[model samples]
Target: MQMMEYYFGLISVVAQSSENVLFLVKPILPIMLRIIAPVLGVVVIAAFAGNVMQVGLRFSTKPIQPDFSKINPNPVRFITKMLFSRQSVMNLGKSVFKIATISVVAFFLVKKDLFWIMKTMDMGVLQAFQLCLLLAFKLIMVVSGLLLILAIPDYFFQRREHTESLKMTRQELKEERKLLEGDPLLRARMRERQKSYAKRRMIQEVPKADVVITNPVHFAVALKYEPLRMGAPECVAKGQDLIAQRIKKIAEENDVSVVENKPLARELYKRVDIGDEVPEDLFTAVAEIIAFVYKLKQKEAVNV
Candidate 1:
């Protein structure tokens, strides 16, 4: 319709003037630009808006990235496969159906309008032209609307197909999981090594302790205190069951005082970590223990 308008305008301008070709060209250029510019602008804006509505403002270079491995030098094989593929056949069928449906609809619309126009033979040329323009505009809108409706199903199908194509196989999924969380066997070994190192360090600290407080058999906590170096007695090592036995053995070997205080031992093991001072609530209990251990050491030193 816009093209027809441009052509009609050009003809009207030329018909009014017996001017030279150069003079005609000047008027024709401006009229052509005026008729074409708005239509072109509307088309460009509509295309951009439709794309934005479908997939909003995303920037990705993956689509444009070169993958030379996918390129086939032999065009014949590629073309044959492309044309005969199931997807290709389906697309061809859909295209043919759309074209046929739209053609049938457009033919009936034009035929009906033409019949009406012919019946009113006394209508002026300008009025007939206006009616024809209105019919053309309606035809364009109806066709576009039908195509847009058809495109919705195609969009969903394409999205599902793309997602399915990108799905990983079982082996691929396993490999990806390993990459994310590390190999199971290797992680188990790492945890075992960490536990062993911590146990060794705890055993080494037991011999340097001033006193080993015990839950008699269930729990053991070894503490060390130095007035000049530490503010309060700090648990140097703590353990339960077999580990408690090991701590007690090391303390005995080093001649460290072993005290049976089930409540204090359990409380210190639960509340104080290795290298941390006993809590303020246990200050009086720990102070008396430390003072007794110091007195015992002083008596032993005097006898030696």
Candidate 2:
């Protein structure tokens, strides 16, 4: 429709000019380039914008990969199956619907304009030409708007269908996991070895603790302090449940003081980590506990 309007305008310009056909022929190449440039520019921009909006920026050579199987000459098994596919059927239906709708719209518009033109028979040639152009523009706008509305749903459906088609089976998922994470047994053994080393290091630190605060059974937090070497008590080891039992047992063997302070033990276990200082809010309570433990140790030393 746009090309038709452009051709009409070009003809009108040429008709009004005093130049002969031979003279116009000399500059036809430049005129043709001017007309083709905008059309090509619009097509290129539309193609790029449509792809970007649908899938963003993606680089894939899969579509262009050579596949000899696709060149099968069997029409019933290959070509016919593709022709009768769901997507092909849907596209055919959409094309037919668009053609029917546009035809109906153009028929009514032309009918209305024809009646107006007939009623005003004395209208000038230029006026009649302008009226036809106006009608053509309106018809094009209506058809383009309808097609654009239809295209939005089709684009989303195609994207969703494509995604579902790419879903992996259980076997494929297992293969991908093996490729990415290596052998399961080997990974598990490595994890266990790491935990064993960490637990041994934690047990070694427990002997250096000045006091082991306990939630009595569930939680344990070991704190160490030195007047000359440290400013405040720092947690040396902390654990719960089985690890807590192990920490208390190791402290007992080392003759470290284990004080039962449920509230302080639970708070330190939750808030403080190994090698971290106790929070300022718990400074006074922790200081009193440390002082009591120190006094007990001094008295035991004097008795010995």
Candidate 3:
């Protein structure tokens, strides 16, 4: 009412002189800012708080990223789902119930005060306005209380729906764990594949060996030496158990000399790797074996 009176006064002033328009508008701007400032401040704070509650203090552009999933390819099915789904039906029913209940409450409230409302016409305009305001306040309080009562069941229903939506399938759970901790099965398969390739490469190198030293049953270490290229004998292949058997078979198939030297084979298999030179501590023993093999090859050459 005061605002309406002020606007009416401003109109009267504008009618008298166009020059006075700026004077009236200047004061109104400050008053408008005073009214809007606190409301704007509250809105900004609430929005900030809501974001913090939902995702902590993190900042990301992902929320604004275009989501193609929201675009329905089957419009007919989308419309049917929107209108006929259980959730839609429940929401429609709740809206109808709320409107009907509020209408009934409002009707009865007015009916109870029907006499007092009728007497407002006989009272002064100011008194009638005050009575109307009081009645409107009462209606608002009652309606708010009714809505609060209705919200209790709604809160639990929404909570249960949210919980259901969050549930994951076994595959989804596995994928999520894989993303967080890495896929253990995939990692193991890769390791096994790497070992297989390594073993294949080692077996290939065995055919190039000058001599194979073996524990006779459990261990094998194949050595190679190129006098002009290599400074010392290098283990071309080394293995134990089944792999040892495989190395010995490969060496024998390639006609590489196999010397039964249990202690030398065990030490080489334990301490050396393919492509590594024999250690300084085992140099004397390895040199003796190499000399014997070379002498045997020379005798075979002379006989041929």
Candidate 1, 1-304: lDDT as tens digits? 5544555556666755556556657766887799789989998998888777665777899889999988999899899889988778878998998999899989888887887668546764456667876887899998989888988887787777768778998999999999999999999999999999999998999988999999979999999998899999989999999999999998999999999998999899899999999899997998899889999999999999
User: Candidate 2: which pairs clash?
Assistant: none
For candidate 1, which ten residues in a row score worst on lDDT?
1-10
Residue pairs with backbone atoms closer than 3 Å in model 1 (clashes) = none
- lDDT by residue (123-213, candidate 2, tens digit) is 6555666776677778878777877887798789879977977999899999899889987988999999998898788889999999999
Model 2 CA RMSD to the hidden true structure, in angstroms: 11.8
The TM-score between candidate 3 and the true structure equals 0.47
Off by over 4 Å in 1: 1-138, 145-188, 302-304
What lDDT score belongs to each candidate, Candidate 1 first?
Answer: 0.86, 0.85, 0.87
lDDT of 1: 0.86
Per-model TM-score, in order, reads: 0.56, 0.48, 0.47
TM-score of 2: 0.48
Could you give candidate 3's per-residue lDDT for residues 175-239 as a string of tens digits?
Answer: 99999978899888999999999989999999999999999999999999998998889998988
User: What is the C-alpha RMSD, rounded to one decimal, of candidate 3?
Assistant: 10.4
